[model samples]
Target: MAPNDFDNSIHDFDTTDDGSGPEPSPELWRHTPFTAFVAGEDTRAVYVRDHLPVLMPSFVVDFALRCTEFRSLPGHIARYAESQAWGSAEIEALRSWQRKLVRAGLFISRTELYTRAAAIRESNATPAKIGVIGFSTAGDRADLLLRALGSFAENVQTHGRAVDFLVADSAVDAGHRGRLRGLAGERAADLGVTLRYLGEQEKRLFATELIRRSQCRPEAVEFALFDPFGAGSAGGANRNALMLHEAGSVLAAVADDVLCELASTDSGDFKLALFSDTDPYDRWVFADRADALEAVSFEPRDYLAEQEKLLGRNLGDLLAGVPVNEVNVRKLGLTFLHLLDSGAARIRTTHLGHAGNPAIPTSSFYAPHKGTERELAAEAEIRYRASFASRGALARLATPSVGDGTVSPGMAIGLDHRELLPPFFPVLPAEDLVFGATMGACCPGALSGHLPLCLRHETNGDNAPLHPGEINRARQGSVFEFSQILRAIMAGHQPATQADTTARMQKLGRYICEFAAQPTLDFREALHRIVLTHESQKIMALEHALFTEIDAPEFWRRDIRDFLDHSRDRMQHEDFDIPYELKAGRTNEENRILMQKLIASYGRLLEDWPAIVAAAWDLRSEGKQFSASAKAD
Candidate 1:
């Protein structure tokens, strides 16, 4: 049946006053289970139900199995059947059985959900006020800081896992935070953007959220790691490799497989300097969890400016040392997909219905802010139309012989010549293959030395030109007109079917005469001639030699020589611009070269007359590349 035969339903809910009572609520459109076991809730179900079955019958196997006891379905019982009919009783019974099977497990199915729960768990493991890492650039340096902070969270002094999201939020002294904020603001200003740098309040909220979501607890540590450089600090503490690895790992753990990159940082040595502005130890205070350790002694600024420059360079060098792995990024995406759901399902479901269902409200007041029912339906129709149009275009370029016997394997459609062909030709595989052979013969090959062989490619100077195959099917048909005339002339001598033969002869004669009147070959005429020409000259020569040359060896040898020379001269003619006929393209020249080589094989007959002549009869029977060198006595 054609695609147009399907009973397609276009659900365009009438918003105007038709007053057919309240239409099915958009909630009913909530994707629901078609089968209890398989989540008929997914979008794949909609595709299978509405489209795939019509296009690809093979996909129906999964659906059939899901809905029926497909394995037990009866096969044809030829022995029991007196005639070809299966009978109405059997058909009815089958339909009833199929209906029962479909309804048996039609609803109340377990729903499949993406396993993104790990993401929530990871987010809760961090202890600090919220950690903010820039998605692209600041990511790497932010990663380093997180890892160093993770080590501290893991230490006995700081039961790292006790913190939420498995990350230790670094506690920066007020002076440092202020400096970082100032730097970030300045950079943001230079870039002409408003800066909302993380302050105490934002940090506290972020940390609280992380703690609330923690799934696991680990060992804690002493100090937190911070990417002061990433924060836009021109001269401050620098983050290094160890910090990045730890931070990256923790982030990955919390992200539940979301891919992340490290950000850049500045070079500076770690200093436990106590300043009157904001003493690091004095400013430190735990607002919610855990106690602080005893203060260690700090050194005063001795080589502040020098150390800052050296540290900046060292930090840059350290960051430059770590190369980002692209494979890691790719792996991260795959991991994320894996974490979503099992992707190896043979069959899947999709939702196509409107909003009402609580399970899948595809169209709610808030969801899919596209438009009204009519508009959406129009859009769907447009997509469907566009898909079919593109499919047709691809079919044209990819498979011109879609319905013809010549359909290639790459084409989805398969054609049987027995079912479709002109009534004039016999419905035989050999006959169809012969048609292909005839087409193939028109174009000459580089290896085959004949005008009617495969195509050949030839180079001129910088550019190469293709010599077209000799067999033009239209021309061959015209030549067949001439051949039919010859066939009639031969049939005249025979007594059987003389009148019928004569009429055919007359028809053929008229065709040939009409074609002959038009002195030049039309494109179609040229094509026909090439197709029918075959290896007629060679076969004729061999046949004539067997009959006449058996009586005169020397005479036969001389005739062969003359034939070879004449053919060679004709093929080698410099004025023969076969490229013009071929119409040059990338592969045209190659085909022309094939033709030249094939025609050039006749030169081999002259080189080794007896051998080539001997090989000629068996050559067509074998599938191989063959050539003749030169004529020899």
Candidate 2:
């Protein structure tokens, strides 16, 4: 029968007669012995009821000899069966007995039976420590581990030997009141073994055991764990190494298993490779303490000061030391500076900080304030904007005085607004410049390189909801028109005439509106593309920025190039090098169609140069007039 066809209630299966009778009422079954066992009461009765029929005659005799009540029950059943001539004819009678056991919840499910049998065979072949780590509040996982262990221990084929298990919980608190502990302890005791809990001192204890087992020195083990910041024990790297040094192998979550394996290797020598996720090419390898310290000491103080001088602002706080909260911001600023110096046209930005905000104090960056939401946000904005201006970029603070402003020819449009924009458009302030520069350098076609400049918006203050009409108007008025001008300059063979530029802009606006109206447009897919592009771009941008800031750029460049090549090789060796697949449940054909549309749009942006320049000039003139009018008022 199908799973759905089965009766929902256990009471539907009769225990008496030929195992076929009227289904019992749910209320009646609720009070049965099996139900009582399931409710955590009188488990021994259910256990005995299930196993008694399955036990061999000699085992039953021995058990009966010990217990007075069941002394003659096994004998009586055997005699009765023999008198009736037990054979194929008595198969229905035997099935009825099994059905009764099932109704009592004594018979195991087929899956559980096979699993237990398999575990028993494995344990008999090779005895080893079976470690189970459960996260705090994950009682279900803990229960599953305990049940599997119990099944293996109770199986007769396994010689009734319990497996050694270490139950570790990752929760740092001293709350040991979980019911899994009690359940595991009881089960372990029944199976003649003890349940062990590994606490905060587990690492040290395991390490000590490992040293004893392997007869190795404490300093022989090294850990290669994920630690973005060199915070030592706080980041768990130091602690992991210490544990593995004392213990031959450490038990950790699947994510941390790779780190643990670094220590478990038979060979004592291993190199630690630390690389920035933002820049795949930027890497450091620490063979010893000296290499690590040397890598850390490469300062960008002078480089940052040069940028600060350009913007007429203090950016020492951003480059002084890494703030815990704004780790990525410094890299972002450096990337933007490098791109600007590399002859990229006006870098676009969204929500770049205003000039009014105070520079973050050196002390504040090192020791952050732990306070209410308002205080934290205030501090974060300060650091965020300081980091942006660290590279000498101007802030396009959105105010009512300037209404949806214009971009200069070969310059980025600065949309410094408080309203939230569509997910596809680059919304992050100065970070967009970094992404744009990287994208421009790495991607094919002139359009991919410059498309980023058209979408940048420099926002300030909190995000507020924007009306769909307002969003549509902003996209149509400035961004679409600006993109057309860029496309004409980059891809158009001939100089753009006034008429050609005007025609292209009009067509682009219509396309934007039509695309927005489409029901099939996936906002999530657009967001995913933005993220992927950012990641890929950031890698190149970060490497370029690092090379520009560091002393002996040529030597460092060679090293970084070699490191990236090696890293790529490693990824390939590990089967981690996979080609990008179209996401958001899109077919290959759909992806191709979308790409063609984007390419066509980019083509439209490449029109006549003169027309594009003229259009920008007109917009700037209009913006100046608006600004003058606002000032006059």
Candidate 3:
């Protein structure tokens, strides 16, 4: 209790000269514990005195994650991460490393980012190019496109001049073109927008024409068109981009199954809201209107009160009245161009959210980090049903985003000026992730809104599987429907600029090419090594985001064990055999060669991206000039 109660100097403490080394002082047992209890070693003597952290072994973090019981109330690993002064500093150090790394070269470094932003300002972009692309390949989806056009028509009818577009069709089929032309003539007045139709023959011609005009290599043009055996989606999406570019629109895109559901009610808005975990493509609501709202949000008190009422708080008075800020969200029908204008993100493209059914696999549940991993199909169905049914918008809006982390493209995201981006790979699963990664690296901004991604509806109901063992069937990960994070790892998602992304794609292309060049038995092993390193790095990025970017510790801690369990199981299983099996017509050897060629196209596209973009810009300029000259004449 007094100043003289204990000696102040190290000389007063007890120690032993064991000869091996000076023994720790007898007072060593009292070091701060980082957990509720210690099941393993909790203390260690200083080996490197220079470093300030005096925490226990590194596995303690894992121990915290795996802990079945929380002996200490109200403190999770995030809390433990904070309680240690050294840990806080260490985290800050990691955060600083990421901020520097992300800014310098994710896709483009912050320097290049600012440089491009400045150039845009200098050029004073000619009224942001925005268009809604509906590339219909199937003759049957005409009705769906018509429905979307109906929405567009209504917007124009409601707000004149706010909606205007011109569509061009160079139809190859005489009959189809004639019909389309007559239909356009009839509908143009009502729709308040231009309408175009490109049939199968026209699409093929356009593909060849685009290839020829761009001066692409013979192989690239061949690959883009024929794509023997139908091995890729690149041709179609590429066609969609070309269609939009030719028509002079570059913003939103839609598919056959997708609907552009603008509200007929007063609360109508393009509810491509932003959810922290996903992008803003959950539900479709769009109009031909452009007005700005405050960015980064400025919520009123009534917002919280309304949220509480909706969430069933104070149930006694359920019908409580509260003011709603309609203006804050009424601008939902905004184009992606407007979002970009208001500084949402400098993304090469944007992917909106979806609502029907999520785009993923049932196999995702095959290997989960949760304790209920082996739950029966009935149980899992309940959970899944509950998840899909939950519509807690109030809580979702209140939940803030993790700074700068990106969500991959939703099912129906907007794509603009496709040639400006590197080509998508032919054989790679989850290839869009690689494309998105490169795009994100180009700019380090992600718009935060209240929404979600993917909207595929369930093929089955809450009942049991129609067939025996179907629900609990052990499906392989090799299927095309699943997401292989490895694709992103290959594309160097964490850091790939236009130049850098091209180099990485080229490198991977070379690896694939080399793998197929010879009759080697180590195909799987070779691919394993390449993926292993980046997977580790991906995990590190996840940790960096969790510890530094987001504030919800309890909500995000579930991801810590994801990589850990992944490492444990993948080593025991040959999960790296990415193809899993041979293609129908080819043996392993032939398939490898086929894969190499397909992958090689991606590299070539990346290499020619700058040229492709320059050519596209020039064509757009020429078209604009031609219009101006014609007007003057």
Candidate 4:
């Protein structure tokens, strides 16, 4: 049966006022599990029904187990299969959007784009654009931007290259933006890397102005400042990366990932031949000492008090001139990043790497492997799932039939081109994947070159979500992870030109209208399956990324296994009964009612995507500092 054919209850929620016929009455809706999950979601805590483990089914084995046993799941698990299918409902609409890209002849060379645009590649050691995509709650992650800028200055000192740093914040916080800009100016000026800040409104105004100046009927632009997919989101933090791509430009998103530049070359003046590396790191063993120590929370100011809590021995000795083994340094790094006083930075933007506690509550469908060491290993897998997929994706870009896999405005990627690549919508956490995939689809061989350049940095483990030894069950769909399955599956059906892409989008709109109205539960169930499939494919992709395991240090290999083993005991503390006090929020009925409203809203958004993408692309295009932004009109 098609994925949509699964008989699911979460898909049955009514969007109508009467709640008549097959749809439940509003009064009856109050008691459903779907509503309870979303209405009651937050970063802190929620009760997990015993059978529905918090672990994501990212592995094929886990996903298979869930599908095999899905029919026998408890009512809450089955009902909650789609507490928020609305998110997927919106994302699924992008499939219809892809067919619109005209399958004109493919060009696997970046030079073709420059030739077609009548543009020349600017030769320079410095990147063309570097925008920092900072999405947070009231700019709580201002520190990350600060840290990234500091690194940029350091990078200049280290690599001896000029930088242009841009911060395009999606969160709605003006005062916060002002404060960051204030702190950034003097620091940014010294390097001569002009720093520009744009909040959502400013970005829109800039995009609108660009559109007005162009005088092209707004629909002609292929990029968006935000909401490229026409789904109701800025796409994700990676949207800025897409907007920054123009012709033969090399751009980067100043994110938390460490910069370990590797050797690269170019395919003539037009194509950039560089590598985008996602070098995975254990939170405790970061490549950089400062980041490593910060992860385990080493407070030198209050060293005496914090040491007894974590290392028992004074890390003062380690920080001092005292000598130590690599093992001790790793241990200190863990404590340095861990501060018992600070639990899960509460900033809630997720910054695209912090999972386990995503900013939004997503699908709760899970397999039966609740508390196994294998499940604990899965946490590490999901934490960096995109890196694996992105590594594997190089294969798609490197296909002999396809052009060199060169991505534009690539972050977590290094691109050689410096021209226009369409900006992506921040709808799903996988916006970066979308940005890369979309660029690849538009010009499969346009990439200057394909090389694996993984950046090594601490990931979710640095977020300090759990106590020293605790790894809680996590939500699969959230801020940091990409729906690689979505991108991977859609890869083959790529449209050639933006005009063809629009045509396909129109066809999808018609299908969505009918699909939403159909009594069949395919759309909701199909989306749900995609979520699981993403997890499954994620684990499978690790094979491509982990070929370097043979070179890992003995200590990292031995103790890392022990740490994961130790975490299993801590995670096995399962609880099905959430106390009334602990579960204080909307009642089940209230949550159900709210869910229906969201489902209906998402359905509408999905249907309206084509119009939304066209307008938003024109506007969102302004969010990046693309020199060609004016010409894009």
Measured by TM-score, the strongest candidate is 3
Model 4 bad stretches (over 4 Å):
1-138, 157-163, 210-238, 241-249, 256-411, 415-420, 448-485, 488-520, 529-633
lDDT of 3: 0.34
In the range 141-212, model 3's lDDT, one tens digit per residue, is 334444545544554355432433322232234554455445544565555455544443444554455566
For this target, which candidate reaches the highest lDDT against the unseen true structure? 3
Worst 10 residues of 1 by lDDT: 446-455
How do these models rank on lDDT, best leading?
A: 3, 4, 2, 1
Cα lDDT of model 2 by residue, 1-633, tens digit: 122322232333322221112222111111111211232231222333223423222322222222211112223234445555667555344434433443444322322221221222111111112132111112234444455445333432244322343444332333332444566667667766544544334434543444444443333211111112111112222222222221222121111110100001111121111011122111111222232223222221221111112121112211223222211111121222222222222111111121111111111111111111112233353333233232212122111110001211112112110111111111111212222322233221111101100111112333322211223322211111112222222222322222232343344434443433334446324423443343344346536644554533343334335433433333333212111222234554454454334333323222121232232234333441111000000
lDDT of each: 0.21, 0.26, 0.34, 0.31
* Reference-based TM-score, model 3: 0.50
Clashes of 4: 74
Clashes of each: 110, 22, 28, 74
- Candidate 4 achieves a global lDDT of 0.31
Better of 1 and 2 by TM-score: 2
CA error at residue 91 for candidate 3, angstroms = 15
Return the number of clashes found in candidate 2.
22
Write down the TM-score for model 1. Answer: 0.16
Better of 2 and 4 by TM-score: 4
TM-score of each: 0.16, 0.18, 0.50, 0.41
